[model samples]
Target chain A: MRLIELQRRMAADVMRPLSSRAPGVSTYLTPNTLLTAADRLDIYHRQYWLRLLDALAEDFPALRALLGERAFSNLSKAYLASCPSKSFTLRDLGSKLPSWLKADLGRAGKYGALALELARLEWAHVEAFDAAWIPPLDSAALASGPDLRPTLQPCLRLLELSHPADEIRLAANQGTLRREKLSVGTHPAGKYFIAVHRLDGDVFYRRLEAGEFQLLRRLERGLSLGESLAGRIRGLNDPETAPSKLRTWFEAWTVLGWLGE
Target chain B: MPANKFNGFTDLGIGVGLRIPHYDHIFSQAPAVDWFEIISENFMVDGGRPLAVLDRILEQYRVVQHGVSMYFGSAGRLNREHLRRLKSLVRRTKTPWLTDHLCWGSVDGKYTHDLLPIPYTFEAAKITARKIREARDFLEVPIAVENVSSYAEFKMSQMTEWEFLGEVVERADCGVLLDVNNIYVSSRNHGFDPMAYLSAVDPARVAQFHIAGHSQFEKYTLDTHDHPVIDPVWALYAEAVARCGRTATLLEWDDRIPPFEEVHAEARKAEKYLPEAAAECA
Candidate 1:
């Protein structure tokens, strides 16, 4: 067989379960013995998912801890089986987890947002650690112009949720939160905004106001300073004088090295 | 060419995988380490703490790049962007050589996020060797491909993995990282003799050695670098060193990482096998 076809078959063999319920596939050996090709292939496929799930759990400890071991394992297994890893590194395994959790099968009303928020927070931490680092845009260069670099570090991620995600995530990580109460239908009211970024070798997140979050989202989408602030400014707002609040926010961002030129 | 002439990083001495848990200890205390081995993917990003910490570590010690995502044996074309970033990282760190796994990670442009094994067929060997040569020529530097631990063997494989490894290295004119723990793990998983695998490797082509730990289940052994190195693996490593002579050896502990001192102590354990490393330190 062609190498690609062989690999696809191998992947399929590894991914399928050992039970009789597994789909019809080619098997060179029976699953009974340790050295059986079926058993060996199963081991690889099992390890493949296990390793990724273990790594993802490690990355999203708060989510795992919040869900309890049994629930976490089941959820992770289902998620992984459904969305087999598409990246070359285990680090990329949980990229879609948060969104997945917020979707129909994943959205267990009460804890759905919390699970997703935690996943997003964890993914952000991984991205911040591994994402390319752009030297913060030079202040002098940005002061002279409004253009932003397209190659700005892709590490910065913004998360908006319908629950107190930051607070709940912190509680989960601290081990003070109880898993029993985090049932599928138990969601709380109120929307939350957060910004996940890396600064000086650390991953950090700060809660954001809805307006502020929108403004940052615009800037992240490559909007110029003037364009991003054009409608957000309040009474007496002008690029030079009236939008003093926006200027302060801009200066704070620049100092934090979040802005790229 | 003589084997000695092909030896790279002979001066690097013994090192351990530079994990994050040891950052503060190595940076603030400046521990007595000969060199540090870094997973290139950890620092492949634009800007972040990992890179910043790596920059600081590079300033203080010798650093070499070992990657997990190069997927050298994949049938798909090599990711040139990935290569460009790696080359840039090499230039920045002045790495003596770059190393990655000898396994295929993706097929038809879809990555599985695991070090998937390749068939030990002559066709597979030829194609893999060609890609390695291309990567080496493109990067303008020698690349070391490490053998990975595998749970399954291809029924179509015509040769043992070690023979395939030896052939690939020789054909590509590249170096072998010779991960000892992987050999032990794969042997246990596949019912092969680890010693035979080591014997088949061309010691002259060996550029580095990796010693790590694995976890065992009732059915098979898993290459999980969570614990200290097992005695049998260390013994195998000693035998490998005896056969390969002195090569840069690194300890890798990824999960449940202990304190830096403990990890360093594990790395230091390799010294007993390397009189050269001992003498250099002495």
Candidate 2:
């Protein structure tokens, strides 16, 4: 078979349910004297999915631990079936998972928020590892003008969640929380915001106030220092008092190595 | 960066996979490790604890890179980004050679992420060999391809896997990373003769050898790399050493990785097969 045809068959085999995909030309064996073509194709097809699912489980142990083995496995199988990976890299596998959870509320049911949160967290971790490392923004540059690096590391992620997902993740890991009775229909009592960033080679997350989250979002969108503060601090009785807050934020950001001038 | 020194192997002998669990012990205790083999993808990132730790390892040991995602046999155009990152890493580590599996990963453009087997046909061999040559030319160094264990075979293959492997390496003028355990695994999986596979490879091009444990299911064995080298694999390694002379050998134990001592012991077992310690020729 031509390479294109073989690839098409392989893609079909990868995407199709196990029993239906066709076997195409393979490099390891000869055609049809012994083992049937379908039987041979089944081996690669099964393995392709199994290995990825296994990797996802391994990478997201806390999520799996929280969901229980049986539930997590079933969910993973369902996820694989619904969204066959398009990228060559397994690291790109979970990119769609958070949105997938949001869209498939019925399927995710009570676990929808938790699933989204876990996906977000896992993506953050992966991005942190591969994210570009830029030298700290020059103080002179920041003072002089405006231009954020377009190729900045994809690590800094913002998550606006309905539930206190970070606490739940921690609680699940510690076995202090049971997942059996969790519900997805109702939102958590209060709004939850988070800032995920990489610091000193480890991925870290901090809960953010509503105002702080908005301020970071504006900054991320390329607003200049003065403009960002103006946009967020409008209508305040004492505008001069915001300098201390800005100073504290800058200090925290510098320590995290997030500032790039 | 000190002109990226490449002194070749200075009587470094065989090494084992530098897994994360044994990081502290290996660095603090300063075990008798001549060289260390690290997965290229695991350390291909910017500053981190992994690099910091690897810096400590590089201080006392020779390091080489072994990668899994090169996908040299893939019909699609080469992944330049991956190659660029690999080159950057090679410069950083000053590795002698970069290695990956001798199997196609994707067709047009979709990576299975597993080392999927390729057919042993003239066309397949030609394409793979050409890609190897291109990769070597691009990277400006030798690229060694390792054989992978497979669960099934394609019916369209015209030649044995060993013949195809030999043809590719010879035609491409590249090196071979003869993985002994994979030979055993493929033999069991496809009902082939492992010795014949070993004998078929050109000894001159065999740059390295890999030994790892596999899990046994009811019908077939899996290259899970979760345990120590099995007895049969060790025997094969001995044979490979006798035939290929003293090549750089690496023991892989990716899953359920044990302590530093255990990995070192597995690596030390290969020492008996290596040619007697000689002067540092380089």
Instruction: For model 1, state the Cα shift of residue A54 in Å.
Output: 2.1
DockQ score for model 1: 0.42
| DockQ-derived CAPRI band for the predicted complex in model 2 | acceptable
Model 2 per-residue lDDT tens digits across residues B1-282: 001112243335678888888887986899888789998877766655667777888888889898888777776777887778777788888888778898877665556777878767788788888888887777776678899998767666788989989888888887788899999998987888899999888776777888999998765688999988899998888778777666777889888888888888988888876743211111
- Model 1 TM-score, all chains together: 0.84
**How does candidate 2 fare on TM-score?**
0.87
lDDT of 2: 0.73
Runs of candidate 2 with Cα error greater than 4 angstroms are A14-42, A61-71, A137-154, A180-187, A234-237, B1-11, B276-282
Q: Each candidate: what lDDT?
A: 0.75, 0.73
Candidate fnat values, all: 0.53, 0.40
Candidate 1 residue runs with Cα over 4 Å from true position? A17-34, A61-71, A98-156, A178-188, A221-224, A232-244, B1-9, B188-193, B215-219, B226-235, B276-282
lDDT string for model 1 (A153-183, tens) is 5667788876655666677778776666544
What is the C-alpha DockQ of each candidate? 0.42, 0.42
Interface RMSD of each: 3.0, 3.8
